[model samples]
Target: MATIQSQHKWRFFRSGGFDQVALDSAADLQHLSELDPKLWTVLNCPTTGLEFDCRTLALLDLDGDGQIRVPEILAAVRWSCERVLDAEIMFKAPGLPLSAIDDQDAEGANLKAAALRVLEITGKTEADPLQVTDLADMTLLFSPHHFNGDGVVMAELTSDTELAQLITEIIQTQGGQLDRSGGLGIHGDSLNAFYQQAAAVVDWHAAADPADPLFCPLGDKTVEAVAAFEAVKAKVDDFFVRCQLAAFDNRAAEALNPAVAVYDVLSNKAISSSDKDVAALPLAAIAAGQSLPLGEGINPAWASAMSQFKLLVVDPLVGSKSKSKAGHLTADQWQQICDQLEPWRSWQAAKPDTTLHQLELERLQAIVAGDGKERLEALIAQDLAASTFADNVDAVERLVRYQRDLVTLLRNFVSLSDFYQRKHKAIFQIGTLYLDQRSCELVLKVSDMARHATMAPFSGCYLVYCTCERQGETPLQIVAALTAGDVDELMVPGRNGVFYDSQGRDWRAMVTKVVAQPVSIGQAFWSPYKRVAAFIETQLQKFAASRDKDIEAKTTTGVTAAATPASTPAATAAVAGFDIAKFAGIFAALGLAVGAIGTALAAMIAGLFSLVWWQIPLVMAAVLLLISGPSMLMAFLTLRRRNLGPLLDANGWAVNTRAKINVPFGAALTGLARLPAGAKRSVADPFAEKKRPWGSLLILLLVAVAAAVFWWFKLN
Candidate 1:
């Protein structure tokens, strides 16, 4: 309940049954913060599903929370106003004039420069105003080879071949980030990580010098030797264990060796030296205290592995000592070979986890020794320097969008002027729905029909929820408020209509649900009569159907009796004859009932005609009021209380005021069918259905007879 300050002199206009602060001038926008939040038409609105520009809404949603609140709106207004020389430019559309920026402010000066740069890149002159579309492609403003202030350093930005190669390698190995210019590149953080990892790889590789025989027993061939030895290490160990078991018990040799049944199974298949089944056998034959044969006698499955092991291991360890040793490796010699490569195994286990391991050790040392890291850091720093300019350029685009959309949002959000004035549609008024011989302009996009219907009834307006469909587009649900038309044709579900969206795209709309409420006082006045007439018609139809069934049954019974041959005339008379007394009694009862009804009608007519002419009309009016008065009163009250708050609140808007849609405003929202003014018409029709006058003549005859009977009784 904070009052407006006297110095600001705030202007107010009443709409939606409440006072709304009118943002009439630039000063109003500047002093918007001073306006109390309670007076604002809307406290908050969702970012999506609105007819307004989503981009502008996103910019105004400073916290990226998918909603724009009062505070965010004020912040956006203040920021845009401070950057521009004239705050009035915000009310303009299509573009922002570059010269209008307040160059005295540092941020505004940067924006001006960025705006000029944008125009220059788009092949426009300085006199031209920069538009949001002109800055659509940011690559035009920032080249991949130049510093774009994104802190990412692309290889193309460097001139030195070595520095460029270093950047390219880092991107390929460490995975680069996306730059503002759309190229993948690194920043200062990635550059430092790359060097730190490279240093670890260099130090890890330094521990395994080739000249040191302990780690590299075979020098450059040690890596290949390790691979060869590992392949048959387990199989060779199994063979030696089998030999030791044979020495323990000579009878155990037969059981330790491959059974004869295994050889029989291998014999059936086309076995190779690499056959998996054959490889499962021992590397060599088992015997008491036997050395593993390095040549010729090894199993075919393990022959290749044994040859590599002997060439790399046996030749190096045995070292040309007399050809009499016979190319066989003792168990102790195998142990020596495994022990020789232990240091290399430990070094491999300690290797650093880095992508830099793919690079040569010498290249890594060279990069660490030189100033390549420093140069890369300098390039990254250069890119970061232009970050302020890039940020302002982005800000310039936001301001341009704000210029065209901000005030429009203010009008809709703060005061609903756009809706009340009827000059333009409000942000929530999605489209017009043409259905049931009427056009509805107050339609909202419904996300969930059932959920919306639950709260929509509280709005006190007749709503038609339709599922709108178009080819290749998802079916959209929308609720249209029918404020001006009758509900007879609109109350039914599955009724089809055409919906034209804000973009004028036509969708075939089908009514999925209807919230039945009074649309107008005229409709309400006749509702009672319509209901009574409908009830009478339904009862008449049922009565006629039952009478028709009875007549058919009677005719069938008579035909059967006539077709049957009676034994005598007496039997026939007994079967079909009518009694005179019964006929007299039936006629008398019918006469009495008709006379009683006639008497009641005559009495009512006599009573009606006893009054004076004025009294007669007054009596008739009182009767009419007794029937239709309650209906019209209820409708009037409901229509007067038709608030737009609940409908929008259901769609995720915090409407603060009682935004009423009264009778006059409701009538404007929904348009009824009518002929245009000054149009010619033909009352006579050649093809029209012929009307019979007999029904009217009958009604007149009945009224005249009742009148005469009443007069005759009065004269007596």
Candidate 2:
């Protein structure tokens, strides 16, 4: 019997027979909580829009399994409220330094330390006050950097100079030893060998006697003469040796003939020139029964005569042969001897040329100086130092960002307690009910009921039942918003009623049990609208069916009566005979009927076209309202009168309070199933036939064309 007073600025309405209040503002909710702590039930409920930080939610969870239950929520609310005053002081002046948090408690000590670190890494002095801007700046530190890794403040060498230094150091350290061919640097031994070879050629030239034409030829003409004689002598010796070997070994003949051919050419030239005596020695020796010493025992004078040749040719050949079998050369040794010949010959030709000698000396001197080595070492050192400094900077930044995030999280969780304490409804509710012969479970929670609720007669508020048939037996369950009347009717423990759900599924529901409690009944002034809708629906359906049956009967009777005359043989014959006058009269009547219909349609169309475009839309809108106004009005009125009394009474409850499940509150009671976040699932029936939309598209195209043609004509 308690009615809400208008002066209180809070409105109260009867819902499910209980005095219910709608708290619109934060202050209104706070006042309601002060009136009764039980009203704080909404604080423990999981809400959709609050968007609590995941870490804060986890901290409140206590068990750490990511679910915040009622007990956890209540504990969080109490803890936060107790510490709220301390938090408020800090929040009121966000610019306060870490020293502002002066509590002796462990949590306070941790916060103070965290605040100090945040200020330090953000490049703020300890004396500098923290601001909202500082917190925002700290969040930016978590942004992604060039490096690919997790955590705030990654190693970012953004400075071009620093990055270039890093690249140089890497190249000097790992790629420092590479040669021109991209192979590893030459060994110390190879460097020494190169120097020794160059020195040897120079020394040989320096030691040469200028007076001895054989050892050192000074003029171009003299050099040519000496080279020709040496070449002819060498060829003759090689040929004579091959001929001697051919006498003992048949395979030697193959090499002997080629050498003989070269020797004959040289011998003919020698015989006709002044060098015949020198060239004929090896040939005459071979003809005499003596086999020339091809190994170490060769005449010493002959060897000495070839001493100038030794460094240029003989020494390399001898050295290679020494590495092989006695009097025989291995393939590798032969190849080495041949490979040394070209470079040796080149050196010999350039021995007297001072220009090349000076250039070679300068290059050798530069290599031994070691200036490049020192520069490379300095670069490596710089690179190492830069890397260490960068790593240290990143570490400090990460610590600072971590501290900032923690402070922000604490601020959010602490403030949320007041927010929830002022709230008045649960995110969801659960109940047990019976439908037909089956027990049903209900999870009632909705986001917005005013927008989603149905406006169709009893659809606004009714006991909805859903039945699932299994194994030839159909089981029914009730999924409805209960009213006081429904509870009262069911309180007897065996009340039965028929119910229909949104899907039009029928259920014969019966009350199996009822729990006694303080119940609310919904009784509003608009309750009569539901009754009116039900009456209208029933009467309309019955009238339409009766009228359709009557029309069908009349049509059938007329057809039967007309066929009776045709059925008789005499009448059929008369009807079949051609009657010009009668046919003409029938045609005239048909033409007149069609003409009248055409004329009336043309007049209506012309009247519509005569109206201005703006007025035409208004007229059409008015006509539409005339057709659908009654149904829409009925639905709207019924929706406004939606009550929970009949639903609750049907389930047997002694209602004492008005617990109004209004548009908004009713939504939170019944939750509809929705797709989970990021969920994707596709189902396809294998037996389904593929469909072509072309036929429907073609029909739509034709309709559009016809409309366009009509509009064009109308405009003209």
TM-score of each: 0.76, 0.27
Count of steric clashes across candidates, in order: 0, 45
Most accurate candidate by lDDT: 1
Q: For residue 647, what is the lDDT in candidate 2? A: 33
Model 1 scores a TM of 0.76
Question: Given candidate 2, what's the lDDT at residue 91?
Answer: 27
Compared with the true structure, what per-residue lDDT tens digits does model 2 show for residues 543-632? 999999999998887688676756678866774568889999999999999999977866666677678869988988887666556656
Candidate 1, 284-376: lDDT as tens digits: 889988888877788987777788888877788664644315868777777777799878877888999998988888999999889998878
